[model samples]
Target: MARSTLLEVMGRHVQANHDTALQCWDGQNKEYIPVSYSLLSQRAFYFGERLVNTTKADQIQGQVIMIACHSPYATLVAFYGAISVGAIPMIFPMPLSLGSHEALTERIKHWGFAFGTPAMLVLEEGLNEKFHSEIPQDIEVIRLSDDPAASTETRSKSANDHQPKSDDIAFFQTTSSSTGDHKAVSISHSNIISNITGIRLAVDMADDERMASWLPLFHDMGLVGAVLFSFCNNYSLFITTPTQFVKRPSLWLKTMHEQQCTIATAPNFGFDYCSRLISEKDRDAMDLSHVKHLFIGAEPIRVSTIQSFLNKFSSCGIDAQVIRPAYGLAESTIITSISSHKKPSDFICVEADSIAIGESIRIVDTLAFSDADLSRYDPSKSVAVCTAGKAIDDMRIDIVDEDGNKIDAPGITGEIAIQGGSVAMGYVWGGEQLVEEFPDQYVRTGDIGVIHNDELYILERIKNIVIRNGENYLVSALEEQLAELLGISHEHIAVFESDIHDPSSDIVVLVERHAPIDEDQINQLLVAMPKEAFPINQILLSRAREIPRTTSGKKRHFYCRKLYQSGDMKFQQAIEVSPQRIMQAQALVNES
Candidate 1:
């Protein structure tokens, strides 16, 4: 029989056994604590019983139950508990830093009213206290305790009396808010199962495959790709928090080594951070030869970053072929396309000027091109794009022009559109289902990309394009060029148009500075920019971590631009080219 809903999958795993389902890292003890499938099921049922006894059945039957727990175990229990009761569960990250207390309270209140959220589950005492004191009485606040004894006494009718159908909503995922405000994407149980099935087949998942992840539970890649996928497939997983990984990158590797995990996933930044921060001593103590797949996605995949990571970790038994650059969005239930494990990621060099909408890209094939060849390409004239691989099973990808007509020619840049079983039903906001974003079962991804050799290649978000003087430039490409010229990580740089509507508006460049760079260096950087294609207009330098970023470490270019325009971003130094200099550059372009 085919499994339709998440509850069905959970039911299969509920049989009492000593087999480990999850190995949660204890950061304080520096060891992994195992959680069995039967124990997890029991705790989830107990939590569901408590929820059913306290809240009205009508309130939870199909409404949203918000979860903001820090622990992965607690969060999963809360998540499954909500599902057991037929309520939609939404996981959100708890506030990591001590910011404004009132602001946090207001934000919680806003979500409560907006989603008509009946209850909130939290584990942290400080968060529990804040909610009780400030949150409205209408919104019930439930504090989950980690103590085992607290849940042992519970035995009541399980909330499984009403079962959900395959098309029923499984959960809600929020956009990263990189381009705009956060919106909730409603994914169905069938959507999840279909995506999981596709990913399993695409990666050739095995019965003995063990997984490890440090990504937060709130993110789609962590929730769907790591947690739910493993749970549904009965794969053993090792889990930890993002904070732990950031504090000690070695923990992730050590856990992987000890557990002999075969699969792991992270954004491109994770590999870069590990390569840069992990000590040589720690690297020598670990072996990654057993790691079969390292799925990289959720942000732009930099070839340079991947090569650097491979070179740094090759001594630790890491293979260059394990790096899999993927492309996905929240609307697709986590994965759309992933590079195949059969070969290393493919790359191509293209003339930058030929990347305009509805135009065929001119491939620079005169040289034997590879990811390492990025340094050879002229930053302003060419770009090296990596393949995100073919669409997964039953998923169809098409590159469409502005008119929504499909672009038939390969290598022509257009908006990427998807049609697949995993496509989300629609978006929700303030407890109301918004109008359908996808019509005719096709989703316009709002991402710009191309098709080359029958494989998908991501370029940039439609919103990330900067138009000046009737020419368009990819902001990410420009940022990479600037980073290379300045000898810094591209992750620390942001480039966008100051006034998107004004063709002659200044091109704003924001750099997050880690070390001091003198004025002369900055001036040289400005002068070194390609005079014809790029005119150095304004540069702003802020302290490290000042630039706005999503939780997944992607630069929020639109948000940063708004901050710059409003004079809210705190910058240590600001440099602007005079109008005469700008005119001179423009004249130079005219002469060319």
Candidate 2:
């Protein structure tokens, strides 16, 4: 019989596998420390035993247990431990260099309240003092440790007696608020297990597959795709924190090279960062020939970024087919669709002007260009959108109109809706919105996408669209064009409307300045932009890291718009372009 719950899966894996381990990178030592499955299971059981002894099983059962830890090992233990004793675990992001401490505290408080004040907060030992006073007094706090004694304790009977049903919520995944406020997505045990099974089949999982990841544990991609996927499959996983990867992008590649990891995952920015920061010498020393699949998701997939990454690492035996463009969200328990491993990624070039709501996109071309060729590609005329491939097993994807009616014809732009076993039960907080969004067992993804060649191609979130003068402009596409024109990373720029509800509102652009640029140079760059496509009224150059971002490195466009409206955004330089200035800039471009 098949396993019904996550606890059963964990028990079966531990009983069958003893050698497979979870390895964590030690940045200081520059090496990975391995923890065997046997030891990990023992520690988890011991932690669960402690929890059950302290609180009644009925009281903790179905209660939220929030985990905030820098160490993947601690997080894994705490996460499984909570589930072992029938508690629902939720991972929270720790403080990062780019994020503020006050912001994190406020977020934790807000989420805690939203989660009905979690029964407990599990934190890393080092962060106890920092977060102790900030946390509510009623919620018990537990500090994680790596004590060997934890593994020596006998498994508690009470912990083993409390088993969660398959339909019971196993964990709560917090959505990355790139467009709006965060909501807790309640994922059941069967939901995640079904997704894992789908992913395994989609990728054609092999017994020898080794995984490496540096994604944060709080994000759904990291928690479900990397950590739990590896654990449930009994695959050897080499893990590290996002801080380590950002500090040295080479380390992620180096670990993959050293371990001969076959499967890896990262966002679009990660691939971009690696391509830009990894030195030539490091690239020469790396051998990624063993890599079978490099899943890229969590943000908009840029064809240029992937092409540049492939070009930079081609000499290291990395094949172009290894790159897989994927699409997923917290609502789907991480993955809804992923590119097939048999062929190279597919992309479609469409006329930018033709992309709008409830309309069929005009196809410009169908091809995947190389990095050298893409450098000459004009973003003003067209945009190349990558296909996220077919839906996974037992999952159905459809394009729906604004009225929630299904659209049959392909290439028509509409909201993407997913119906599958992997879909979460509902949001913990937003019940009313959940009722509207989740209808007929299908979660209406706020993303705007289209069905082409029996595959899903995401364009942009509906919330990210800015309308002016009866024209809709995709913020992400505009950001990409502006970044290319200004010769900067798109991650450093954020473009959004001053008021999404007001069509006449000013279009504001915030660029994080990495180096000093004179006002004339900025003007020249602005002049080069396609005025008919995107007309900027306000531009601000802020200090590095001034623009707010979610923990997953996604720009909080809605939050940034709020900041701009409140006049709270800090900037070193500001430029307000009048209608006369735009006319003059257009005239200069025409004359040149």
Candidate 3:
């Protein structure tokens, strides 16, 4: 807290641990490379000086700078370089799926539209043409060399010569499109520090703890939580690329085991992927006993995924309780609530229809509630909901109904709204805050959840629900039930509501299974589904692995619905062989 800003925090860590090192994967040599704090400082200094000179020539200070780099080292150097010289840095996603030149150009142009021309852009080669064509600012795109500071490069000036205040904007993190499309959340030096400090305390971090992370640096989890936090706390960090994890997730665990990492994290789907993808042979050889807290959050925490992963790896010394479920969003700087102690995650199962984000706080000041009141809020009686741990220090939660009325009773579904120090400055559009009708500080998370036993049980985002006949159904729960009934993995199914407000709007469920469903099974499932979950007016089947999802593995219900409404989507009917219903089904399937 004594440090004025992240610049000071980084400086202190470098000064104190000059010899301490970070271990990163070297893809070419298939070995981990050690990069010391002193070396990082020198590289940062070199990049910082380059930025300082550019901004000085442009006669602008505090110019927003964008950095899009694939290599973690290059990104760290570019980011620190920008901020060390008083320029704000924004780390952008380097889409690995950019397979074609047109795709790359469109992606860069899309980014340019969201971020009004930054004074300087630090990107890897071959991405500047599209950037320049779309942006109108007097922009200078700095190409990051493979090893910019590897040679005998001396800084012409001190790295932290330009000091920024605590209130200075540190960076802008893009919010995930759970509620909607992504938006930039301006995070301040103080905001980042507050979140890190709170998380450090919540998890009771120790000096000797080792951290390993593969999250993209563009996201707040990797930016503020993993990279910055590791440096600030002086913990030895083992970093890897997200692509590496996707290609062979076993590497994440293998590296963690080899380095004896104590702290690690992933979203729900990450765990599911690793559990399913990592072969039994690979799983048997790995050891995860060193991991103390595998914090799980970023999206809805799936109880089934956690349980299956634990069962699959427990023989390899991976403790079941180490799988901690957490809850937070970009608006709150990544982690607002996380499991802080050594306890098994409390899980509950409830009727999908009965579950609602109850009234922990429908209104902020109008209710008197305490942790002791959690005795009355028993999740086991209703549902595990999420039991997403408690709020971090100085943070408060409110669950309100659709009418804006407070819901104080447990198990009552409502939208989640929060107020805390970790909250971002505000939503930014075109480099300006949208304050027309939004709150000055507190963020309405748009996630629906209920508070029980002093923990958050997230149901789903308010926008993710399917409402028909005045009944709201959680699509995730329906998908889980349908997958079990189909004897297929949950990834094979996607359920959503189309034409949302129309009285005759269809409730469509899509499944991508290897085998087709017969007419009898289809009729039986449709009949039972309405009673167990909700009515599915239409069922569209696609080839396996064809469902679209966000980068974080969240099912893109809205996107899939859009694709289905347009015959342009690639998929065939599952019940196309049924002579009696093929015409009706095809008409509904191709209705869009």
Give all candidates' CA lDDT scores.
Answer: 0.72, 0.75, 0.66
Please identify which of the two predictions, 2 or 3, would achieve the higher TM-score against the true structure: 2
Candidate structures ordered by TM-score, highest first: 2, 1, 3
Sorted by lDDT, highest first, which candidate order results?
A: 2, 1, 3
Better of 1 and 3 by TM-score: 1
Q: Alpha-carbon error at 418 in model 3, in Å?
A: 1.1
Model 1 CA lDDT for position 195: 89
Q: Which of candidates 1 and 2 reaches a greater lDDT?
A: 2
lDDT by residue for model 1 over 374-464, one digit each (tens)?
6677755666677798888878899998778999888898889999888888786664553245665588887778888787877655556
TM-score of each: 0.77, 0.78, 0.72
In candidate 2, what residue range of length 10 has the lowest lDDT sum?
Answer: 430-439
Model 2 scores a C-alpha lDDT of 0.75
lDDT of candidate 2 over 214-327, digit per residue (tens): 988888888899988887787889999888888899989998999999999988778888999999999999989989999998777778778888889989988778888888
Using alpha carbons, what is the TM-score of model 3?
0.72
Deviation (Å) of 308 in candidate 2: 0.6
